[model samples]
Target: MKKKVIVSVAATVISLSTVIPLNVTNPAPTEAQETQQQPRYMTRAEIPAQYKWKTDHIYSSKARWEADIKKAELLSGVFKKNYQGKLAKSAAILKKALEDYSTLSRIQDKAFVYANLNADVNLTNPDLQAALDRAEKMATAVSENTAWFSPEVVEIPTKQMNKYLQDKSLSAYKYVLSDIIRTKSHTLSQDQEELLAKLSPLSSTGSDVYSRLSTEIKFPKITDSDGKEVQLTQTNFISFMESKDRNVRKQAYEAYYGTLEKFKGSFAQSLSSHVQSHNIRADVRNYKSALEAALIPNDIPVKVYDQLIHSVKKGLPLMHRYMDLKKKMLGVDELHMYDIYTPIVDAEEKYISYEEAQKQVMEGLKPLGDDYAKILKEAFGGGWVDVYSTDDKKSGAYQWGAYDTHPYLLLNYQGTKGDVATIAHELGHAAHSYLSKKEQPYLTSGYATFTAEVASTLNENLLWNSEYKKAKTKAEKMRLLNQRLENFRTTLFRQTQFAEFEKAIHELEQKGESINAATLKKVYGEINKKYYGKRMAADEEIAMEWARIPHFYDHKFYVYQYATSFAASAALSKQLLQQGAPAVKRIKEKFLEAGGSSDPISILKGAGVDMSSSKPIDEAMTVFEETLNELEKLINEK
Candidate 1:
């Protein structure tokens, strides 16, 4: 299982490649994107075609998608009947069964890639929404139909499975089969698996409700520095925080958190029910706990989870020191949670055009050999990215596609330096998918989420080093270093804080304690205090922060990987800088190209960063400490 588990087809609905050939036309950007007087958000229909993804690569028309869905459903029936009771006949038969599963699964993925991407670009489209709704349900059906496959395979004795792994015909599926056998203890009976598969669609109700809350809930409008009324939104909340005016930041912070605060009860229930779903599934599987259950499929040891918290706790003083420096540099009497995100450096606001961003991404990722660079180039030119902000578009960013088509990225790009790093980050993911798809069979094409973030963050580190060398002024250098610091703060510290909170809540529920609104608030507040230390006030409203983090509802035990991956990436990037081409070769061949062929920790170890040890994370913190020391020195320079 990936970090965000693909339990059902609908889950697959939200999920990616090819290259070296360039038969596709790359359109030039629109004049507005190239040169705009004032930046403003555009509706989806208004965005230029060049800036949008060519989903046509997946399906030329709705008829093609529908035809594929119908064919897949029919194929699903035959697949279920043909392999239902026949897998134990021979090794060859088992391989055939698994191949058929991958084939049918790819069919659903293509259908879903088309429908889900369509809905994302224009989230308000009723037609697209209806199509996606059907796709979601179809995904559930596919899961239920094939629910017996794993259990049947798991029923085969481990010795027999080891023999099956030796079969030449099952070479590609060797790891897949071995993994299933390893989970034999956790594997449920066929009927229970089917019932659980059926329950998946229902399990998503809380997630759907949480998703709707982002758009449906009306937030209070706040006044900007210019005395203009502005409605606070997920898209602009952080943007407002970046304002030079403290009042605007405070108002935006209060308005957004205040809105989430009102719905704490609802979010609390949604989150608790969501956590309960995880506990119920884990309990039925006879796993020791929810965290163990979640970690098992990915081959992650519970120690890895505990070690991250343990290691991070040892480094709390560094986090507190950074906060203390932020207060001194900003000359604030008290550091409020809202006071963060304001720039400490004096660099003038700059916007790197989307076209420029693509070039920078190319330059940033060039160290990974020319073949990898070519793949990224194809992703940029081949419309693998849907760039720019638009009305009713999904906020935030992600890379998703089907096995048949190359990876596609969805971003509400706003042309800031941060956005440039984002382009590099996402393209790293797209590049990983391309290499994996080109190298591995469809079944192992997708890398686990544990390993996926490594590629992205490593790119950012490389980009930071390259650009920092080019900084001509102290302020420019300060800005870049500060941005890196924020990554340490946000991706490392903040996510670790989240990891701890999630662990506590799950443990509480496992102990049969109530996880209601009050309990949730109290637990979150306590964790916030510990994470931020005495420097942070642990504002009353900060306790409600968990309410807005959708991953708790969408995927349990997820955020911790953000911290861990950053730690691993920081270590790998250091290796790359020191070792050069050989390091890049190891990264691609051992990590990105490996895909799901091996356990994630082993994959990372092969690439030179061992997650099982505390060294990588501690080394990552060392980078943070060095960065802070540099920033503090710069602040004090005459």
Candidate 2:
């Protein structure tokens, strides 16, 4: 039998793909120019009608949403009758109940999607809000009603379940039954399970409140580059960060973090409560740590996490070398934090328009083969993507979709070099989902977070490689290589630093230490110093950086996967590019095709990667070192 383990609430609530807190900075505009520029905000009707999904067909009115809610409420009775006390009976009934569950789930998903998409756009709309509220309640009810299936299946005598699985009619559910039996050790009593289920909403309230506060609360006024004061907000902070003037970047950083500092205690409390919730849930079940609990669901080995931190720590010198190169390229006497983002290339590439970005993404991804490229092209051409950033637009980017519909991507597309990379990154996810949905059963279509970043990062690596080869001059090549290294350092090293900080805090909590703002800052400062090494000054405010990361509040220890996935992708991309179609085919079949059908390790091993060894991480770091060498050569030659 598989080893017995308990899953924690953190494993469920703090999964990957949490929000990234980006500081937006709008360019300082002259009064005349400000008058000339059109308002950036778009009304619901003004938003291109094509971009909105045809939700009328799904639910024509609020009354329809209510009716569906009623139907969903009615499903509890159906589920109870069909699934309760019937697991010991014939296999046909079990199969029928599973089918029923899947069908009802599809309906629930559609209803929730319909309500959520509309409400997200117009948060103040009462009808949409009501629809969303109803949908959430219905979902919780369904979760509570279905909670018994796993425990009951596990409670069935193992011999009996195995015997049932051998029957011709029940063999299809062999994996499903096996998984249930494996979870027997973690299953709580019906009352305890119900109580936990009911507490979920309240437990999640801290994260919900943090989201509202962060996104909706007004920030203070700050002076811009021209010395004119303007109100700072999440929307405008991006433009500020990308400011051409160093003073502006510094000012923006101070102003933005100043706001977070003012509310640091609030943010700290929210995050601490979130971690505490995870600890409590993990303790209730039988898990060694929140990290172990988080890994159990996806069967990711703990060593993978350790390897990521260790390898990235070993690679920090390479990063510091890259940092030094950036300073030299910029011809600065001393590089400040503000100088890191300034264009390293004298003739930086122009921002690609959204249309051009789409074409470039397709061109860059062509090596993935025609069928995959074609689906991406269709997604780009179709209104599946909500492109472009606007005032009050959702911050950051994501690939979102219901299992039944074509994947939809929400991008805050500003026409920048990084924006082009973002396009490739998000479409990587879209293509992965598209392929998985087409290739696997609904049950297996959704992949765990571990493999999710591989596809996305692979596309990014491809785009960088394609762009690097096409550069005309040494400077251009250096610039492209610099950008690539910067991506690696930030996505891999910086995120690992975050992972380390998260682990430290959780361990502190586990040790019965109270987590407050001062403690968070001190711990974060130490981790930042350790990860970045002594080469660069670890700014005190960088400690407050923890408060700004939404991932910590929502996803505990999830950032490490970005480091691991990218490292694996870097290695995979190298194999595919140098070794040819056979390697590419192997990756597509073993990594992409396996989807969630197998454990992450098995899936990666099938793709010719063994995370148990340090080879992939070593290869990725070697790439970083090589790129650093190339940058050094370019500088010396210049």
Candidate 3:
């Protein structure tokens, strides 16, 4: 998901995370002194000042945020009156107009992030929540006010726009101008665009209902391997799956999805309505399909989507081979769906403190050189992250910041190795934004998700390899290898399966077909059966998997970027390791610092991976097998 950029009128892309609702209740004051004490769990005040992000660097106080909001609101009206009919009058006018809009946008974004970051820390706060709500609408209102800008720009004939481009004064906006012209066909009239803007909030209705229901409904608790009861949650499902106990995995699976099954109709309707909303928007915009509408804005073609699904289907035999390896290594009589997540190498459990996690990340990113390492150090020490889970902090993790502020990370850090890898992954995002914002103007600072995952996942690969080389024993190496392989399997293979499922559903919706809970389950089960092959069984509960994936409701045709990004990053990671400094230099200069200065695919090409071809993906698939082979070698030796 793209980070929320509420500041820009030209683009208002908000990325959705796991979407778990924070259902925290305020605890009654203890008999002891009660001046803002921590809740039964930790509270916002209990978190160390160092661990919480210092947003004062962005804005000193809420008053400042409010003042900026007023300034932006004032500018929004002046902006429309000033540029509504005169974008093509002169090159100088066009340049100045864009610059002013950029300035107002930066202020708006800063205000938006300030309020929202405060709210994220203590989700139960009414004051900050209200401020955050106002900021969201204020930003959207500005966008709605400026809805005519794009269509107005599109009205200018390309030949005349090219003539305007002859002015060296507008050189900075060359690609931005070209992109507007390129997408001119999709640009609608001012009235139509405004209508769509008014309808935008309504589009999220289905998703909103889905989020509220999922968040409020409590799943059943079950016994862990330790015989103590554990609550199942979106955050801890995978953690439970990591247990050595197969029954624990089975019960967790059944219990989690079992709760989801009861709400299948509601979940199905929410998803169906969400997909229909996208389809309707695409139709109104004259796009051929919902997928085309989603992909075209990012400069991706239909064939890239087709090519990915095709290639993955062709590679199912290799996937099955990996599954068979898992079964053989586990020595199970028959591999059930529950057996897949069991760790093949039961290494001694180790907890890495957050301090050590930062150190390891800094050390692991060394191939990128001292400057990159220095950025990671600054991010760690500079209060650019909220490092612990207390009550009701947003679930899962994401890297979010306004163009004016440095990136702020939200983490629910346990001391597990996976947590360390997550630090590397998220810091990769922070570092990318840090570097890009330093080099590019506000208009160019935000990179697209298609290329964004490359930086994050590349860091993951680097960190895993760094740790793998240091493993003291075969068991340690196997654990690291096992962890690393699941990433490729999930990001490259599983997400492609997801990508294909999304395509099938969208096409079904396009044909005006009904897709209820049973329809979704049937399609999802068939895909899993084909992807996992005969070696692994698709649990009856597995079909209900679609019920919980936030991405399905959050963004249309979005998850494929994860697969595409991993392919590019894996290829680039190998290059950086093998080709050394030269490759590192190319990736840093061409990709990381590139930002949205170019289209996503072009930025990827500039970094040297041509996603238009399947070669990078194929190379990544090869690594998956090599990992299995190494695992087989280690296990047999043991």
lDDT of 1 by residue, 158-254 (tens): 7787788888988888787777777788989999998998898877777877777765777889999999997777877777888888899889888
Candidates 1 and 3 compared: the better one by lDDT is: 1
Local distance difference test values of all predictions, in order: 0.81, 0.71, 0.78
Q: How high is each candidate's TM-score?
A: 0.95, 0.89, 0.92
How do the residues 493-522 of candidate 3 rate in per-residue lDDT, one tens digit apiece?
899999999999989989989989999999
Question: Of models 1 and 2, which has the larger TM-score?
Answer: 1
Q: How far is candidate 3 from the true structure (C-alpha RMSD, Å)?
A: 5.9
lDDT of 2 by residue, 213-261 (tens): 6776677777787889887777567567767767787787787787789
Each model's backbone clash number: 2, 11, 0
Q: List the residue pairs that clash in candidate 1.
A: 16-401, 17-406
lDDT of 3 at 280: 95
Ranking by TM-score: 1, 3, 2
Query: Model 3 segments beyond 4 Å from truth?
Result: 1-42
